[model samples]
Target: MASWSRLGRVGNLAATIIAVAGCGADDVPLTPEPGVAARKVTVIRGDQTYPMTAEVIDWETRPHPQVPERGMAVHITYRFRSTSSDSSAISEHVELQACAVDGRRVVLLCTSIFNGSSKDCWLGPSADPDLARTADVLILPDQMYAGPHAGDPKDHDGYVPPRNLGPGDQL
Candidate 1:
């Protein structure tokens, strides 16, 4: 019998597919979420600041459900709204894959899945990776590279080539 965990993976895959279509981050620059006021920051990545509410900063090691040998790395999850809003989890999500930080400037190399199956990447001064957590923006980049997760030995492959940002990858 398939474990509940297995069923969960199948479910999350469908949800992730739908979420990917939205493309949370972009090169055009993400404005602070409308009415939400900017958080206080003594440090700034540039002149820009993105409005992102960090829902979960997971430090736990999560591996690929299919290939447990893959993606044994930590990641952070950001949500546009409360988790309760998710139905099929058809809820919206933007999972940052890797991130590069140049001082206060951060360029998150993001993805939608833990499996090496996704071909998408989103980057910008996303939520702090906590390694060097001092970002001032979430939609612009000075540079992009391996954030903490991509820095992991087992998870590095997913953050390269087609899965990562291009000349100027994701937002």
Candidate 2:
């Protein structure tokens, strides 16, 4: 039994040495691509102009959740000035860039305060100006507030999306 134990220890040490040597191979140097800057713009909903920062987050291609055979999930982050006058608002819109002819952008989360408000809407892409355009100035009415959502919709004021929106001249 003692001899068997000694042999097992020797075998384990040999395996470790082989593994270490195998991992000590020369590696090819990698050249990273240039970094892309985030597009900073403003969205005018109603009376207030909300500044926005848009970023595209790409992930490994995967099957779509809804349509397993032919779909994929694309993610994006949209940070803008919190709509709330009293507090700051920072929310994210994550959706799958479907392959459909007129794919719709979905809102995954509207995080405000601590709770998340559910919002489902189809948004056009920025590439297709006809479909989606950056909102440089957001406008809102005096009675209505455009801050992030509260526990209830009535908890906050209503808002109107900005028109003639585009990327800001200087970001």
Candidate 3:
């Protein structure tokens, strides 16, 4: 009877361990709902302050004619309106700062603005769409680059690459 009880306890412990191990950090949901995914972050750069909202509008994983590997893409929409009305206070080149995927954070070294008013715009491919849904996205304002620097460095001209901004520099 004692040996049987010990075996049962060991089985229970094994089951408990399996259950705990199966639940990873990525299993925690970041967004409460599908559409209502948004986070507000305030950024202060130099003498300027930008009140911004970063929202995950859409996520997709599809084959791209350009990318044979069929990576994931995340679409993040941003709205920014400076508290100050001064033209100098206008937020320019607002872009993503970093994204956290399964606890691993990747600084967005490359990003783009899809479209928006002076107060609104969209930026994305946050990570690969495959990884974006499982990641926490963070956006911030930084100097925008002019050309294609994220892709092949040799394919573009005058592509002055921008350095990844640290957390201290971002929101």
Candidate that scores best on TM-score = 3
Model 3, 21-109: lDDT tens digits are 87886643332211111244454333334454344343333333355454544444455545555645344555434332333443332
Clashes of each: 3, 25, 4
Better of 1 and 3 by lDDT: 3
Better of 1 and 3 by TM-score: 3
**Error at 55, model 1, angstroms:** 4.1
Alpha-carbon error at 32 in model 1, in Å? 15
Q: State the TM-score for model 3.
A: 0.37
RMSD of 3: 16.1
Residue pairs with clashing backbones, model 1: 97-110, 99-147, 123-171
Predicted candidate 2, C-alpha RMSD: 20.4
Model 1 per-residue lDDT tens digits across residues 45-118: 23422232222232233443455443333334333323334343223233332333334343333333321223
> In candidate 3, which residue pairs clash?
72-128, 72-129, 72-130, 73-129
lDDT at 129 for candidate 2? 33
Off by over 4 Å in 3: 1-38, 50-69, 85-88, 91-100, 104-133, 141-162, 165-171
Off by over 4 Å in 2: 1-40, 51-54, 57-61, 65-67, 77-159, 162-171
Q: What TM-score would you give candidate 2 relative to the actual structure?
A: 0.25
Ranking by lDDT: 3, 1, 2
* Alpha-carbon deviation at 95 in model 1, angstroms: 9.8
* TM-scores for every candidate against the unseen true structure: 0.23, 0.25, 0.37
